[model samples]
Target chain A: MSVELDIILSFKDKMFRLAHRITGSYEDAKDIVQESLIRLWKMADKIDKYANPEALAITITKNLSLDWIKSKNNRINKMQIEEYENVLVSKEFSPEKSIEINQLHEMILKLIDSLPAQQKIIFQLRDIEGLTNKEIAEILKVNENIVKINLSRARKKIRELLTKIYNYYEN
Target chain B: MKIEELIEKYFEAETTPEEENILKEYFTSANYDKKLEIYRQYFIFLNSERNIVPGNFLPASILNENSKSKTSFNILSYKWLAIAASFLIIFIIAFTYFKSNVNNAAIVITNENFNEFKDLGTEVTFDAFFKISEYMEYVKSSINDIQAVNETFQILQTYNLMNYQ
Candidate 1:
């Protein structure tokens, strides 16, 4: 395979995963990845010139994800006034380990969803996607300090929320 | 380290990657105190969530479909030909319009010059009438002695004579 194809295949999963985490919806994530692919393909001639194809792809994915979120939020706000109603309702917990695991997953997803937009993105990139603060800073086009601050804030918020839920379950 | 100190360090941005790994190890161990079991579950939940991959097939399918899409321009639509023809027609029309306008202006200028010359002829005739009137008043006594002066006067006064008749 050509370097271009190799690079694409190598970064495709990372791009999709990052996009998925950023958008919080599978379909939007897929669309963002496809859009990023199209962009990379269109600029194929310049691919070899960049030192880091993954960084380029990540930047493209991040920007496209941000745009997708903005548009999707607008559409959701316009069409669905009862958007958060379902999320706010608590589900009954089960004693089975599998059921508990599933419930825990849902709760974690909800907690992540409740995060502010920038913090959510920062958390997704830093924690879920396993990107370093420097890499995330490059992808987000911000200072490393900002990335650190956002990541710290996001992690702290998630920890507090998880701790509260845990205490409630324990008692 | 005390849980409070660990949590404080985590918040203060002082935790190194090694410290974070230690915390994760501490949280995930089965032998951690019962009080910390819930915290253990939370950390396990986070660790599991990190690699979950979301169970989504849409991104792969989209990429497959996108790969199949042609990046090259389609000639079958005839769009390029249509654009070229439209541009050619516009250029031709603009050229023709400007050429005709220039030609028409030249023709109008020539016509105006011809009309001016015709008006000059009328002015010359009017001047001749005035000269004849002055001659009639100044040299009325010698008017009859001039050969063909009566005929010239009669030719000049033909319109007046016809109207009177």
Candidate 2:
């Protein structure tokens, strides 16, 4: 396969996974990935314009996911929300394990969601995507310092929420 | 740096990527503090978060469709050709309408007695012209009356000044 084809094949899964996690729905993630792929294909002539293809693809997926969320807000049912929360929580603990793990997962997700949109995106890119701050800064089109600040704020918020949950469980 | 200083630096975003790795390593190691166990769990959650992509069938379908459409069109450039043809038709229609309007306007200007030849009855023209003139004269008279009122007020003020003197 050509370099372009290889890159597409290699990154497709990672891009879709990131989109799925951010969107919290398989259908939305599929749409986001398709949209991102289309965009990448259309801009294939200018492939060199991006410093990092993965970062570019992730940014595209993030934007497409956000647009999907905004457009489908009213259509999102409670069952779907519960299912997505289940997916994230299910990863760490099985149903047989203590419910505390599941509860902790849900609480952490809630805390992450409560963060400002920039901070949330930064957190997802840095921690969940395992991207360097510099890569995130380039993808987000912001200064490196801004990415760092948002990541810090996101981590701090999650830590505080976990502490609160721990205290509650202790009592 | 002290552990507290490191923790503060972490939150303030002053830590380097290497420093961040150190923090993560610190959290996961046996040297971890009890109060900071929650932090450790959070980091583990973040680090272990996996990406889940959909199966190959989806992109394959897209690729198949793209190839099928390409085969159907003898020239891939036909799409743009069709768009150009559509725009050409629209342009022709617009040009015809514009030319016709211009011709109509010119005919209207050239025919000096065109209005007279029109089927409007004498009474309609007489009523329209006379009513419009009457309305204009009414407005003119109202303005003259206001001017006269102002002149009389000025004369009265002059008379009062003479009496005071």
Candidate 3:
């Protein structure tokens, strides 16, 4: 009913997605989303006057996610190694199709992580989270053209990485 | 335009986001040309991961969490609060330093400043403040960074206060 509610309803899921993608942990993502919402909730009275409240929300979510990742770098590295060992261990134990699919999921995440910082953020904002170019530009504090170029580069690299995997799997 | 045309424009960053979405859809679709097999699963994976929202995470729940607890440790205990409070003090110090020392780059907070507060004996006395302030400068200097610095300051809230049976 209220403008704040409208803004939160519109962007909370997207904020969660942004946080989750960047942090790679659902619990931390949820915490970041919750913290971002609390911030937005504080500004609820003045939210409507902003030109694009969703951009503000996404920006907050982005900053918080970056902070969360920085704080958890050690834990994340441990998890990645654990996940790597997981896929390795399961290679022989699991059924072929499921293993391949799971490995593909992990590899995609790795590929996304491998991208240059700007390109990865752009791809996450554009393709994964589905923000418009202008919205992403606002969120990243960059020009729309920058967003476009980064997204293009990210996609090209992802395509190359996936092609290698697809080839490996097929042959 | 032909799908090939769209794909070409996409690689060049010439397509609008909406048109890119169409390319995404076409690539993931069953009818897409088999020659694009290399990119098919990739697109499909991107689409699936794009849509992967964590379940049962509702906006109302976040609001509810905020409203549920007014506990003392909830928000104030966040390190940002401490850092921010420290930053304000540093900013004031910087302001005063800039007022006095127009020639220098940094303002040193010497042991002399702590002496001024040392006489004020109370639970929130100068000693406690000194120790707590000490923990701040070492690792926190990077955090307190806003053009003010001092070679002195030590201690940050010790365990003796909570010594209980």
Candidate 4:
């Protein structure tokens, strides 16, 4: 295989996972990954236009996923808010003590879902995907300081939300 | 960095990944202070939630699609060739039909010698009719028969030559 194909194949799964995490829709994520690959393939010969092809693919995936969400929301604007929460929340908890922890996890996820789009993305890339600040910055087309600031703000919000939940359970 | 400064930087969102890793390690350890327990569960949540196993390989069709489109430029070039060939085909067919019809008409007029001139609407004499008809027929036949198509082909060849050069 050519070097471009090799890179695409190696990162395709990671791109899928990133899209899935962002959209919470497996089908949409898969479609976005495929589209991103096709776009990269088309531009492979002129890749000198980009600093990093991997980052370019990632940016494409992110933009496509966000566009999918926008169109989906437009179609299903009447969907109940909790329905979305239920789709995102893990329902694998129904025990005596574990149920409480599960609720906490759900609350955390809800808070994450409530974050501003950029902060949420920053937190997801840095904390969950385990990418470096520089990688996140390049992929998102921002500076490293912006990545740090967004991540910090996202963490602060999660901390505040989780602290509230903890206090509520304790009292 | 010292533990105190690390905690301060952690809350301030200024910690490097290395420092963050150290903090995660310290928080998850059993011997960590109880007052900082809130931070531990948060890290645990981040660690646990990130376990989304990237599920499947890229579909075979995706890779196949790239290979399939490698010949797209060839197809595009053939598109132009097909269009040019079609125009040339139509030109040949039309030209042959028109030239043969003209030749056949010329032969009939020359052989008949104005036998059908009675249908003429003019009140002219036979001599006038015969002379005019014969001269016109001769002019038409010579114009069509004397290498008209050959001259057109030569012009077309020069067009192609100019394009190549």
Greater-TM-score candidate between 2 and 3:
3
Scoring each candidate complex against the real one, what DockQ results? 0.12, 0.25, 0.21, 0.22
Q: TM-scores for chain A, candidates in order?
A: 0.83, 0.75, 0.79, 0.73
Root-mean-square deviation (CA) per prediction: 19.6, 25.3, 31.8, 18.3
Reference-based lDDT, each prediction: 0.68, 0.70, 0.71, 0.72
In model 3 chain A, where is the ten-residue run with the lowest total lDDT?
Answer: A76-85
* TM-score head-to-head 1 vs 3, winner: 3
Residue A145, candidate 2: alpha-carbon lDDT:
88
- Stretches off by above 4 angstroms in model 2 are A45-49, A74-99, B2-4, B29-31, B51-58, B65-165
Kindly list the per-residue Cα lDDT of model 1 for residues A100-166, writing each as its tens digit.
Answer: 6566566666666766667777777766566777887887788989988888887776676566556
Clash pairs detected, candidate 2? none
lDDT of 4 by residue, B1-165 (tens): 777688668656788888889987887789787766666777777777666555665656656766667667788889989999999999999999999897566323343665565445244556688988999899888878767977889999999999998
lDDT of 2 by residue, A11-129 (tens): 77777766665666777788788778877766666776667778777778878877776777623322333344454445644455444654566667756655666786888776766
Chain B TM (all candidates): 0.32, 0.32, 0.34, 0.34
How far off is residue A54 in model 2, in Å? 2.2
Q: What tens-digit string does per-residue lDDT give for candidate 1 at B1-165?
A: 876577668655567666767777888876677766656776686687565553433335435544544332454347788999999999999999999898566323366587767776688779999999988887866765564687878887997888898
Clashes of each: 0, 0, 6, 0
Q: State every prediction's TM-score relative to the real structure.
A: 0.57, 0.57, 0.59, 0.57
